[model samples]
Target: MACMEFTPEHRGTVRLEAREYGRSVLGAPLLYYPCRSACRLLVFAAIHGEEPETTFLLSRCLRAFDTNFEHVAFVLCANPDGATLGTRGNANGVDLNRNFATSNWNPAHVQSRSILESARDTLLSPGKAPGSEPETQALVALIESLKPESVIAMHSPIGCIDAPARTPLVERLQGTLNLPWKPDIGYPTPGSFGTWCSEHRVECITLELPRLAPELLFERYGESFARFLAAQD
Candidate 1:
């Protein structure tokens, strides 16, 4: 379910922007937390679109915002159509996560991304050029405008904080979720959200959890996640 699935009576803020993804029908739907303290953060989930699990967690967390940060924000469902179709890429086959303009990253353009190709396919098959997809462009616009202190990108199964270059905050996040101390061995992704955050010197934490039912996940990680966000300063 996208941010629009919530009603005005629901809570928080869901504002529609007139922004379009280039000349396509794709538009970035932004869900913001404008209420109120210290540092602000952006929570990005499901850049893959098929990982509705991340979206489910984010939807629950966004409504339960009581953290050290002055504010928290999310893209909600970055790839709406792909999400609706239960696929990994936008309708036009661009991976919004891999489509970002990065100086060191150049994903080879591949078409029609699914579970097999997913984010890599979009980079391998960048249509005309980088940031070509409406989804990619819209994401760029949103992130540039918000300029949050850090971005925690929610993903699945890895359960490690990937610092493309280096960051103490994200490194600490790995420690926060640890059952035992481990090294930050997350591999490098050239055109990924982690890379983007590393480039900007912002904390970009990629949360990896099991692909379980939302109810079960909440029961397991809700308290831990709250503690994680609270330790963000």
Candidate 2:
């Protein structure tokens, strides 16, 4: 594989193009940057609107490349409406992460902490049924279409690489990001994307970035992350 050069020009602007995979609850386009060849990995961010740092850091890494990746696809933001509204849940008030159509999908409300140290006081709906929200439905369809062997869902504040097994991809991420690997997030995530991927036999790794300002995260991990992504070929 050729070494990917991180051009300064693209760092200021995203030159790579994106295609629409679906629409959000607010009719905003749900976009993803497809790979040039068959996809082996699919990385997505910002399932929770409050975690915009996930999107920001991923975008910074992406802008380092001028062309499409050969085997890695990216979804910079999965819940646009929620991000727009600055709410953890989407416009429909559903936590998109808990809305996947997995066997453990629950119709009950899910509780999340306002901050890592705070109590789990914030309650968000997990949707009336499994995969009820449009964002969840579209993401499911997109994953099916891409058929990637692995998926990395980016989130933040609890800093660790969460996966069932320490596969090569997990090790690569652990090496590049310098985050500890945990088999679980220490809680039950019933209808989470990771669970969905487990049920479907696709490896899933959750990259929980450490709590930091957006610019700080980019400064710390952006370049290494871009190189890590470029090596996926």
Candidate 3:
């Protein structure tokens, strides 16, 4: 694939249009930028609403091209309600990441730290049942439809390229973003999108961006990330 020529004008505006995949709990439309050819990779960001930088950085990367990719698809914001409300969870206060229907799906409430250095004092529901949230259900359906060989779930503040193995995709990302590759995030994540992907035999990579301001993240990785994605096409 040829390198995508960045349009400075498009930087100020979103050029690539999105198609609706599903709706959030608050009835907000869940949108994704579909590929122009058979999808080989699907990269989604903002599954956790509080980490809006994941969405921002991905959006900035998408703005580099006026059209969609030939093989790579994207979901700019997976949890719209949580993002709009600036909450970590959805309108139902359930952590969408923990709502996937995996065999290890737990009904117990999950605790998260207010900050990486803080204690795990904040609590969020894992949904009443597995895949209970509409966002999770819709995302699952979208994956089933696209049938991408690999899926990348974008998250923030952890700053690592996390996958079960350091495959070519992982190596490419590491070289592009200059982030360490970690086979695990050093914690068990039951019912996570990665876990769900593992169960369904889909390769899932968790790209955790370092703790930085959104603008800083874009400045640091925007062009390189866009180029990396373009290369994947």
| Candidate 3 colliding pairs | none
Scored by lDDT, model 2 comes in at 0.92
Q: Write the per-residue lDDT of candidate 3 for residues 115-142, one digit (tens) a residue.
A: 9999999999999999999999999999
Candidate 2 lDDT over residue span 20-131, tens digit each: 9999999999999988788899999999999999999998888777777888889999999999999999999999999998999988899999999999999999999999
lDDT for model 3, on a 0 to 1 scale? 0.92
Q: Which stretches of candidate 1 lie over 4 Å from their true place?
A: 1-28, 34-39, 65-69, 110-124, 164-168, 179-188, 230-233
lDDT of 1 by residue, 31-100 (tens): 3443133336777677776788877766655544432134555565666777877667777766666666
TM-score of each: 0.70, 0.97, 0.98
lDDT of 1 at 186: 37
* Each candidate: RMSD: 6.3, 1.1, 1.0
The true-structure Cα RMSD of candidate 2 reads: 1.1
Which one wins on lDDT? Answer: 3
Question: Roughly what TM-score does model 3 have, to 2 decimal places?
Answer: 0.98
The local lDDT score (0 to 100) that residue 182 gets in candidate 2 is 98
Q: Which parts of model 2 have CA positions greater than 4 angstroms off?
A: 1-3
Full-model lDDT for every candidate? 0.57, 0.92, 0.92
